[model samples]
Structures are given as structure tokens and as C-alpha cells.
Target: MSASVGGAVYAALAYLAWGLFPLYFKQIAQVPALEVILHRTLWSMVFVMAVLLVLRRWAWLGEVLRQPRLLARFGLSALLLSCNWLVYVWAVQQGQVLDASLGYFINPLVNVALGYLVLKERPRRLQWLAVGLAAVGVLWLALQTGHIPWVALVLALSFGFYGLMRKMASLGALEGLALETLLLAPLAAVALGLMSWQGRGALAQGEPGTIAWLLFAGPLTAIPLLLFAAGARRIQMTTLGLLQYISPSLQFMLGVWLYHEPMSGSRLAGFAFIWAALAVYSLDGLWQSRLRG
Candidate 1:
């Protein structure tokens, strides 16, 4: 029980940090979202490499790289993660942070669906109901905006699928992330180089504050990842599922309450549907957990 509680604490802290990510990114509004992503990818690579060196994980890294099959899986994960990062940054910058929250709120349901479809896993009836409710929420958002929130959907799908791939790869968090970041670094460098050549690099013309804020991206991206690795091993997936809501919930509050984003009837209905779905999902998780015990 104590371990579980600690896991929850770790998860909560990670999610809270993630929830506040928009405000941090907002500080560098002068930077293009892709440029920000490039910095994140590049610096994350540097940070992870340093950690690996400190721990002397080069043997493990070399072993993993020698296994071309594993490298291929990690490469796919890197691509998907990159897409998720880029989309999220773009959404936050475009004043659609609330919609991004909605995407995450619906993510667990999507994960469940993927489990059934891709992994051939079976979900109980209540779980199916939860997925249906979440579907309704997506529909409501579509009705509200008179267009599908593709940015949100893409973000959710890419990230969710990335998680699935990571699971399949069966790599430890640090080792796996190090490789993923390494794979992405060259692309990020190219992009950053182009931005510099175009005279639009954030570090070039942005304020000292922006430079400092940009540097925070490396630690911000890495800390939660480290926490997630520790917490995931100690907690049940169901518990993790519940905890995943924290980030989006905080994002939603920041959007509606802090940023004063619009809260129209359609969006309200969408959020309502999502909450209902989560409640059902939570109940089902508890029931299943009890049954397993």
C-alpha cells in the first residue's frame, strides 16, 4: 500500500508538471513550435546521454543498438513521439490548449480500444461503455467546433500508440528514451540549423528569459519521464490510468479558469461525456482489481 501511494505521488507530480507545460512553452512564444520541439528533442538527447554516461550504460546501449530489430522498434516510437510533441506544442501556441486537454481526457479510452484491436485483449462490458462515452465526447467536440479536433486527436493517437510501441519494445525507460532521443537528434539539429540560417532561431534573438526558459525544456521533459519509469514499475496499470487524468484535468482548469478560454455548451457537453466515461472506467478498474485480488 505504501509503495502504491508513493507511485501515486510520483504520478501526480509528473502530471502536474505536464499540466503546467503550456505556461512554460508560452514563455517562449517568440519561438516557433517546431523550433521549440527541436530544442526539446535535441537537449533531451544531451541530457539522457549524460545520464547514461554517469551510470555507465554504454554497454547496454551498444547491446541494444546491435540488435537492429529493437532499434527499428525504438525508431518507430521516436517518430510517433516527435509527432505527439510537435502537435501538442502547436496546439498550445494556437490558443487551443483546452482542446488538447480534451484529447488526453479521451486517451485512456483510445488505449483500451487499441488493446482490444491491436493486442487482441478483451475488455469487460463497463470498459466498453466507458469507451462509448468517450466516443460521444469526441462527437460533441466535433459538433461544438463544427470540425473534428484533428490536432487533439492526432496528439492523443500518436502518444497513445507510442506508449503501446514502447510496451512492445520492452525497454527500460532511460535506456529506451536515450535511444529514441538519439534517433531524433540529427533531425532536430537539421531543423534548428535551418531555423538559424533563416534568422529565426529562438536562442539567437529571443530575450535572456527565453533562453533560460528554453533550457528548462530539457529537464522538464526528462524529470517526468524518470518519475514515470519509477512509478510505473510500482503501480498497477489501472492506477496509472487514473493518474493520467491529472495532467489533462489541470490543463482543462488552466484553460477554462485561468486562461479564460471559451466554455460553450458544446464543449461543456463534451467534457461531461468524458467525465462520465472516466467514472465508468474507474469503477470498472476497481471491480476488476477486486476480482483479481
Candidate 2:
């Protein structure tokens, strides 16, 4: 297959994996979110470190450290990423996987807005229309639910910022994630220690099987990320933007069909509007990219 096709397939697999992640995270329902976050952070670090060594990226670490500005930027990305992880884990454990899915659905729009604001890259008229439609959907959902889905908002915002920072830093996938995990490791270690000292350690009390599954958390986090990185390098940002929908689509299906999350009429209407917006945006992106070609 062509590189573009190959990249698209990898992206699809990565996102599909991410879409089903709620299923995995929910399995460890017995553990506290914080402890789960800690395991995720620690194990992810171990996995990325191995990848880094195999890729001979240990030298890159020294280079990244020597550049204070890059290190600071990566550190900020890590902070945003940590927030995203914590909130997502909390949302899944609290039975708000659907809401988390909404966050991912809304994330692309947020990225568009961020692109305009942060990158000063103006969207075309169709892109603007897409943004407006998404906004209407979000507002309508809030009105019908009588509550803002703040968890979703937090997820979108944190992830959007993380993406923006990573784009700016221009670090490779494994390299960047290694730095991010390293940046967060000390704090996670402290939190884990505190939990242990307080005798509230969530990891200590889980069944051996449960804990063993938790070990998968690291690979679970890193693998899709690594896939995304590889795919990102080969595809245009616009293509990546469109591919993001694949994950949320799966999550939405899982929520409504399998998990039986409530789907009110208003919720359906709101999602329809958002879908319309995404359709416009995707078409516009493809059309414009074609024109450029």
C-alpha cells in the first residue's frame, strides 16, 4: 500500500484502540483514579524508555534537556497531558464514558479554534460554518441536559493544549512522550508514595488479576500514541483532524449501544448538528487540500 494509505490505516487502528479504551479503563473500576493514573504514568514511562533505547533516542534526551526552552515546552505539554489522563480516567470510572466521548468529538473543533487563535491560521468560510454548527450543538446539549458536560470540556481543552504544545515543540512521538512521562514521573511517584503512606493505596488492594490488567495500562497508553505519531508524520494535519472522528464515533456507539448510556432526543439532535459540522469541515479540508495539490 501507498504511504498515505498505510498511514491512514495506522491512524484508524490507533484511534479505534483509543475509542475502546474506556472498556479497558473501566475494568479496573475497583481502583482509585489517582492510583490508576500513577500506574499509567509509571508503566508508560517504562515502555517509552524501552522504545527510546531501541530507537537509539537516549542521545535525544540529552539534547532535549540541554535546550531549556524545549524542555519547558515539553514540560507544559506533560502537565496538560496529565490533566487529560486524570480526567479521562475519572470520567470512565464514574460511568461518564459517554461524556468523555463527547469531549473527544468536540476536541477537533477546539483544535481548529486553537489553530486560529494560537497559530493565527484563519479557517476558510466553510471551516467557520463548521465551528458555528458545533457550537450550536454543544449549546443545545447543555440546554437540554441542564448541566454543562465539564468533564468533556476539560478533556477537550487539556488535550487541545497538549496537541498545540506538541506541534510547537516538533518532537517525535516516542521521543516527546518519553520526555512528557519523565517530566511527570517525579510528581506521580510522590502522589503514589503519599497514597501508600495514607494507607489508601488503590493498587495494593486490587485482585492479582485486576492488578495484572492494570499493567496493560502502560502499553495501552503508549501503543496508540506511538501509532498516532507515526501516522501524523506521514499525513497532513487536515487528514489527522478528520481521522480524529473515528475514535469518538466508536466511543459513541459503545456508549449508546453497549454500555446503554442515556441518549435523549435533545442529545441526539445535538450530535446530529455536530456531525453536520464535522461533515462540512471534512469536505472543506479535502476539497482545499485537493485544490492545493
- lDDT for each candidate structure: 0.81, 0.82
Off by over 4 Å in 1: 1-12, 229-240, 289-293
Give the lDDT of residue 45 in candidate 2: 91
Best by lDDT: 2
In model 1, how large is the Cα lDDT of residue 24? 84
Question: For candidate 1, lDDT tens digit of each residue in 75-188?
Answer: 998899888888888888888889889878877766776677786767789878888998998897898788888987897788778756755656777888888999889999
TM-score of each model, in listed order = 0.90, 0.90
